[model samples]
Target: MSDSEQPGPPEPDDSDPPGAEPSSRRGRRPEPIGDGVGAAHRTWLEPVRSRLVASGLTLDELVGRSGYSKTRLSELLRGKGYYPSWEITYSVVRALDLPPWPLRRLWTAAAREAAKKQGWIENRIQAVQPLGLEQPPVAHQAFTLAMRAPYAAYARAFLQAEDRAQRVVRETFDILWLTWDEACATADVKRHAWQMLRSRVMARTLQQDGHPDLRQAAFFTAAQAAIIDLAERSAHINKMAGFFDAVARLPQDQMDVIVLTHLCTIDAAAVPGIVGLSPAMTHTLDHHARGALNDLYRQHTWE
Candidate 1:
């Protein structure tokens, strides 16, 4: 199609009577057209209109930005008509970048309507853009922790048969509950305790001669500080049983190695001595432990 061949949009025909419907009454506003229309729409659109205008958008600009016809947009803004489908609402919400209070309210309202007829699918359906709905001054904590749950679950299963399984369970809950005790101070204390424990343990072990990187990563090394900060903010689940059922089923020896090397972040070599694993079996244990931890640690920081 040539550029000129594109059809020009038609102007709104005001002469066409609005044709009042059964919903009309004396002093009553015209019904906003939609499926499952809510009262809020009657109240919100004129405000949306004023906001769009205040933000330097002309009526045509608002219409173009919203991907709605000028007539439809005007109808919405006039409180004479509106259709609050997620598609239309999303367009308006995105163009304006609605404030946090209004933004969350929109999703909450949409989600409630979506809930009765659907489950998780509807949850996603109701979710608006900028999916990180966690309000500012606090990073999006809920979704972040939700993302970690799978990793937590997987590692819990992977490390089954290890005694540190309890620690895994504990770490999961600890990560979840850090915010409950006041985020900053409690996190600082936890970080400090782990840090001192790692530094002291490493200082003594290096005197015995071992790899330093292993020592650093094995303990409260700087590499994992972000992990600590996030764990501090986490609030997933606590006071729940079956935390480290994985480690419980595993041999006590394997569990000790994971505790010493992973959570304690001590030298990896220390694990064999601590867990009492034979030199040959140490290789098998290391392979399994690394696999288990890869997911667990990755979850702590996934974007």
Candidate 2:
């Protein structure tokens, strides 16, 4: 099927935490989010909830500070109904006196997972109207530029959205900029920066049966190959799905090596640099990933 024709994952319901006070209670605790797409909600909301409790501001006080209604603030805190837009989220973030950068990154990821339109995300962000992050230091500029395309390539493969992937890459670089002095002092800054990028992408990536969802990625592969016919593309996607399921079952390091090498088409030699592994360790992971896939294929085929 074509990219537009593919169905989105079902939205999970928001539930209150166990034994928590009712939503109307003054001291009610925030809800806990489980795995899967909920991770997107959890990442941003958990921090906000923590800060809200820390601030000891009643809902009424928060409403006054954020200039939003108590009902809206309650819904956002509870992760109910629709995902909150960046503008409102930022208002709450500011009300709690929380730093904007980290929350913004997490909020963007959740927005993408909610399938918010790119234009909508952009307009909401623009409505906030704030100063941007500082430019990367001169020393970090060359390294950041060189890695942008490859980092974005890996991010795009997992995220399935150009705007989301680019935003993630920008956030990763922003983080690297903030810690450039420490990163520069590390034994391998390329490896350090890559890990930072990988963590951000994986945080936003969808999950299937506890593994990163590779099935969604198959759609992009089919598109890039120009497999325009619906029947042919469907067959191709199914075949790739099985392969990627096997790929996802490998050890995390091996899986990263395999996806970086095969899916993103990064060179074998270059992968060690990006993944922050020694050349020998990268080869070992590549070998094990292939062997594991073979074993899985044999077991599945035999069954």
Candidate 3:
């Protein structure tokens, strides 16, 4: 085919379907290649890393569980110039059950960078707003960056994992926190809390494995925050004992969920010796147990 035979430059059709902006360029402006954890990086990285460290997981375990290369992981931990691999970093972040704070920063930084590179950034032209108090390269927009999509996706997963972990811990323990002595005295509250506890423990474990259910991920942040503070401020033994005792009185059907799920740290399906119920029955028991426990709470002084 001759040069002329090749299709002439296609017209930029106005009817193009809306989508993400292409990473194309027309000007000579330098691409904002990520230099060593830029100004914004320093602001969040150290504290975030420290917070991860404080969570109950060790770096070695994180590496082993995440399949991250150990040498590289150490460099990131020290903030010594390694870019975090999302596959590993995100999982540990999720495993620790930290909030979405670090991931949010990652998203913000990416959007800012992407917008900066493509000045006047109009993607899909979804409803143009009259120029507010700011201009193109809006005051806030300048700080954003286009993050790697895989990394961004990983960030979302990490946050979800954290939520799942927190939710599991909280749902399992919330009743115990507000009501203990009564919880222990009644078989009903014991049964329901056990089921709730089992749900969360399973959730956290599932989150670590990378397939968390979003429906059950929201309550943990607030609930765990309060529970942790209470645990820290009061006598640790008091809290732990209260929780243990509450778990002790539940029925074989309901109580087994906590004994096998939370305290034993084993899944019902996997551990034949623990809570030998079929998966379907376990779920049914969970629903029924919650109702029975709530009724018990109404009668007893859980406070």
Return the top candidate by TM-score: 2
lDDT of 2 at 55: 63
Which numbered prediction scores highest in lDDT against the true structure?
2
lDDT of each: 0.41, 0.74, 0.40
Per-residue lDDT over 85-188 for candidate 3, one digit per residue giving the tens place of the 0 to 100 score: 34334554555543333343342343343332222122211223232342222321221222122212222332445454443343223323323333445655
- Per-residue lDDT of candidate 2, residues 1-303 (tens digit): 545445444433333345744334455555554334375676567667876776677776777888876667777887876778787799897887665776676677778878876666676788897747744467778877778888888888788789999988987776665456667889989878887787888788888788788777766673427887878888877877888877876787898888888888888899887788899999999998878787766643311
- TM-scores for every predicted model: 0.27, 0.55, 0.24
Better of 2 and 3 by TM-score: 2
> Candidate 2 — number of clashing residue pairs?
0
Ordered from best to worst lDDT, the candidate numbers read 2, 1, 3
**Which sections of candidate 1 miss by over 4 Å?**
1-38, 79-82, 107-130, 137-303
Instruction: Report each candidate's C-alpha RMSD, comma-separated, in the order given.
Output: 20.7, 9.8, 22.6
Residue 215 error for model 3, in Å? 50
Sort order, TM-score high to low = 2, 1, 3
Evaluate model 2: give its TM-score. Answer: 0.55
Using lDDT as the yardstick, the better of models 1 and 3 is 1
Question: What overall lDDT, based on C-alpha atoms, would model 3 receive against the true structure?
Answer: 0.40
